[model samples]
Target: MRDTASPAPERRGGHPVATRAAARLDRLPPSRWHRRITLVVGIGAFFDLYEIFLGGVLAAVLAAQWNLGHTARSWVIAAGFLGMFAGANVLSVLADRLGRRRMFLVNLGAYSLFSLASAFAPNLSWLLALRFLAGVGLGAELVLVDTYLAEFLPRAVRGRYLAYAYTFGFVGVPVAALLGARLVAGHQLLGLDGWRWLLIAGALGAGFLQVMRRQLPESPRWLVVQGRDAEARRIVAGIEERVAAETGQTLPSVPEAENVPERRVPLGEMFRGDYRRRTLMWWVFQVLQTVGYYGFGSLAPVVLTAKGYTVTDSLLYAALGYCGYPIGSALSIPLIDRIERRTLIIAAALGIAACGLAFGFAAAPWAIVAFGFLLTVCSNVFSNAFHVYQTEIFPTGLRSSAIGIAYALSRLTSAVLPFVALTVLTDLGAAVVFAGSAVLMVLLCLDVALLGPRSTGRSLERI
Candidate 1:
């Protein structure tokens, strides 16, 4: 499970200290330091997804309990996504301009408080408002995790490690699904609805993680970008010492740092020159991919209910299917760094398109379970590939902002997709909704195949 860093002969960055810090990181083998960081950050990601999918799980039950129409149901779900749009677009830029660790904790704290408040909401409007505010905190979390990992992890294992973090994080999906299936209708504990208990659990869990994450060191690469070479060097040296002690292996010598042009790329740099095409491709991919991913993912329980399954049956089926989120992510860990990220993305997306279509028409319980499992597995592989891909293609200066802006649009799609998918399912059927999903996945596959950059086994700066 250990990997010795074999840094490239030459690397590029804004400062020589940052370049050397990156090289030193690349030379250390995988150790407790990487795992600790990955696990710590993964916990935050777990809550992010738990909160995201909890909305869908709650939608059907709340609709029934409150006599919510389709429009009202859509608003309930869309509220969080709308907040995510603002948080991601705004805080992501601040991560780049400010420090990654600062914004990371800030967003986590914001959501944890609001999510707990949401559990006590007196009405639908209060619940929606709290969810929106909590979502603002949820938005920048994953973005920062990605930025942090891509900066610190050795290039040799970067893709796989990110997959590893997400594998643990994706476990939240199944946990949420299972909780929804069991608790959404059960007797109230502590004089609260079962649904309210779910929110409280997520909020409390994230709050604990926020405290644990204070031990995380800021990204030395980011520190260098801020012209704080002494601090960057100290942090990198401390990490190297810890990794060396844990691995008990003689570290390889840090490769000679190459001096590339050191000017900080402007925030607008993503829209110009070589980056423009990448930016456009990311934007388009974000929009279309959300329709395929969240369309089925965030709305599966409701879609099942719309298909005539009872709330219990729908949640149970969703729980079974959501198991694939972690399974699929785990499966990707071995192949993620080995395969070209774009190729993996294209292949998994195609699998999603096919499995989604099959799941749409499946009637037998066995068939439903089979296709749902396959679809989830494929989607996680697709997710793992793209999550790593997006971080790799952008440099340190533009990574957070570019990803934030691009991801914000996906939140927009996620916000509206419920209404769109629900409208389609109501007007036509589940089959049509999935048919549309298939088309969107195919379009996304084509987009990546055509425009996505090759980022396999490459350093962040080189890409």
Candidate 2:
């Protein structure tokens, strides 16, 4: 077992209270309280992915309704990505400044409110605009959740707990797929178009989350860094009481930790030291990873339609493929803490690339679904693994902003990639499109494997 006596080199010129608060937070073991936190936070993530995956399925239906060509179809899919790009970069900077709990609620409200408006869109342009607005919340919500989980969870089982949270989030993938399958079958409900009904479902779920989130406690670590030591101490004390009651054991003494100063961290700090190299690495990974992951996800149904599947049949198959997401996350739960995080990310990426090659060549229904399922499974494993890895490497102060910028690149590339992928699919073929995905995955594997930090057993301060 790794020793906890020394987490990192002690820093000078730091507040004692901030150090004490960080120590208290880093000392707790897993409990029902943590599970509750995950459930509450993870549910919002459900709607984020729900709106995204559901939008992909709706692309074809909307295109048919508007008599849009392939390029317009690509725009229908890309617009939300564009909005997400802006949201991740702009709103995430505020998360570290404003507090995770407050931003979580605000982002949720943006997502839920806009999704409701999206259902009422009278023209293609209105739908695209509303979805773009909704995408903003989706973008911020994802990075903040990763930031929250990393801070709240201790280093020992951090990856596993994160995997569990994402496993809950991944459950939405299958739920979205099942919902897509249902809408394709039912056609409509409450006199609205079937696609509009899908948007309503995401909106209602997010609305309920806003009410549920009121009970959530703010991050003690965040409170400390902001010089609100009294509040941070009170929060940790309550957590200690609950943990003690659950475990029926007195908690061990917390190791001494150096204070993480409460100060204004400029956005430019990321490009200034070792963080500069780290930032560049994630930027490259995010750009390439998005092309392989979302490129296939958002455009797969459209390609299938062009290959002669009816709209309903294409959605049914896509829904089945989406099931792989949760299954992949589930598989990672045990191995996440046990294996090296970068190792898993690299391995999963290669598996996904290999699966992509097969998916492009497969023509039979069973073969196509089989390859797609395999691809999504491997893709999500990489996703859950890296989400934990990314948050762990950065300081609490820089965590949200770092990921915000990285996720923006992920979304930005995804926004522009649809046009590229569709053009390739339209001219060259499905094989070429997926072959392109394979090449990007290879690049991602090299970037992460060579440059990513080892974080599983190290404290956040040490990492």
Among these predictions, the greatest TM-score belongs to 1
* Candidate 2 lDDT, 188-207, residue by residue in tens: 77788777887888888898
Consecutive 10-residue window with the lowest summed lDDT within model 1: 1-10
lDDT of 1 by residue, 331-370 (tens): 9999998899999999999999999999999887788888
RMSD of 2: 3.5
Candidate 2's error at 228, in angstroms? 1.3
What lDDT score belongs to each candidate, Candidate 1 first?
Answer: 0.87, 0.81
| TM-scores of all predicted structures | 0.96, 0.94
Error of 1 at 292 (Å): 0.9
- Separately for all candidates shown, the number of backbone clashes (residues 3 or more apart, or on different chains) is 0, 0
How far off is residue 33 in model 2, in Å? Answer: 0.3
Off by over 4 Å in 1: 1-15, 261-263
